[model samples]
Target: MNDHLVILIRSFSAFFILMIIGRILGKQTLSNMNFHEFVTAVILGAMAANFAFNEKIEVIHLLIALSVFTITSYVLAKLFLKFRSFKMWTEGTPTVLIEGGLILEDNLKKNNMTLDSLNQQLREKDIFNVEEVEYALLEINGKLSAQKKKELQAVTLKDLQLNAGNAPQFPIELVIDGQLLHGNLDSNHISESWMNSQLKARGKKLEDVFYAVKGSNGQLYVDDYKDNIQHPIDME
Candidate 1:
């Protein structure tokens, strides 16, 4: 066999094998891309790359490496979930960067955060001034969550002292994709007759809707014909 051919074969084999292994590792490893997970992925890629174009690489060796990586990740995740300290050690805990309108500069520095970065994060939360912030924490996933001081918080309708009473029922769809969700409508004493009436009012029929669901408050939300349009129910 030509040397080039051998190398190409190895590269293709390694690429496919690694891709499958990575898929099996699951989305948690990629989406959040935590520090440890990131490092593990890099290490796995390095291992695969080293053998990608190597003529001497064997499928068995690839399988063994992939197996070890998968098992180790599975074990670590299980252990982390089972124990509090282990979870903290592996994923770390959220750090309080601000409390009571005061900046915890020491905590920020400990987390390798800069004043500028802190300001940027705070700004993202719409807290331009540090004084408006009551508490801010650096979550383990590297996201910042902030709470505004009671007085600084945005006032809702309730806060304005509105005495608006009970919220009305919103219609819920009990069918989608030609499948009837009997459970959603059965308990409400709603049937095909009620559904037809509801659909006729909106110039639609049950079959015309792509998807529909009844929300907790008995409201119906619907997406008809999948034009990416959403219709909210107003039950007066």
Candidate 2:
């Protein structure tokens, strides 16, 4: 066999083996992997690569290493789920960065995060001013969770004491990419005739509409394939 063909076969075989192992281990390894999980994934990848390219290393040895790493990760996940203390130890606890509009500088230093970084994170959450925050926590996943001060928060229906009717339903997509979503219409208690009527009212045909949605407010929103620019051109 050609050297290139042998390499290709080895690489393809390693890929399939990894896929099978991934399926057995489940999605825990794929998403939101914590510190231990991340380390395990790195080590597994390195071992798999060695097995794929290195002719001196036996495939069975690499397989055993991969199996051990995966099984250990799976067991750790199970332990985290069952024991809260273990979970906290492995994943770490949420650090209180801001409390009562005051920044916890010590905690920030402990977490190796700078004040500028915290401010940047705050801005990402649409919070421009740190004084407007009542509480802010640095979650284990390195994400910031903030609570705005009562005065800084947006006005809610409850605050106004308005008698708002039943909760509005989510907008139901009727058509997407000129394809009618029959299942959505059926689930939303809408009929094909009513949908057609809506299109007719807008001087649009079903096939001509690029997208259509029935909003929670009983409004039919439609978009066409072509842009209808109505702005006046400035020739100057």
Kindly report which residue pairs in candidate 2 clash with one another. none
Q: Relative to the unseen true structure, what is the C-alpha lDDT of residue 107 in candidate 1, on a scale of 0 to 100?
A: 99
Expressed as tens digits, the lDDT of each residue in 48-84 for candidate 2 is 7987788778878888888899889889888876565
Highest lDDT model number: 2
Q: What TM-score against the true fold does each predicted structure earn?
A: 0.57, 0.61
Q: List the residue pairs that clash in candidate 1.
A: 170-218, 170-219, 170-220, 171-219, 171-220, 172-214, 172-219, 172-220, 173-213, 173-214
Residue 116 local lDDT, model 2: 96
lDDT of residue 60 for candidate 1: 85
How does residue 175 of candidate 2 score in lDDT?
89
Q: Give the worst 10-residue stretch by lDDT in candidate 1.
A: 162-171
Q: Write the per-residue lDDT of candidate 1 for residues 1-236, one digit (tens) a residue.
A: 98888778777877887777667777677667665676678877887887876546676887788778777876776776556467767778788898767899999889999999999998887778988887788987788998777666676875566333434233455776645667667876788777778778888877788777766335567777656547867553
Off by over 4 Å in 1: 1-12, 123-128, 150-236
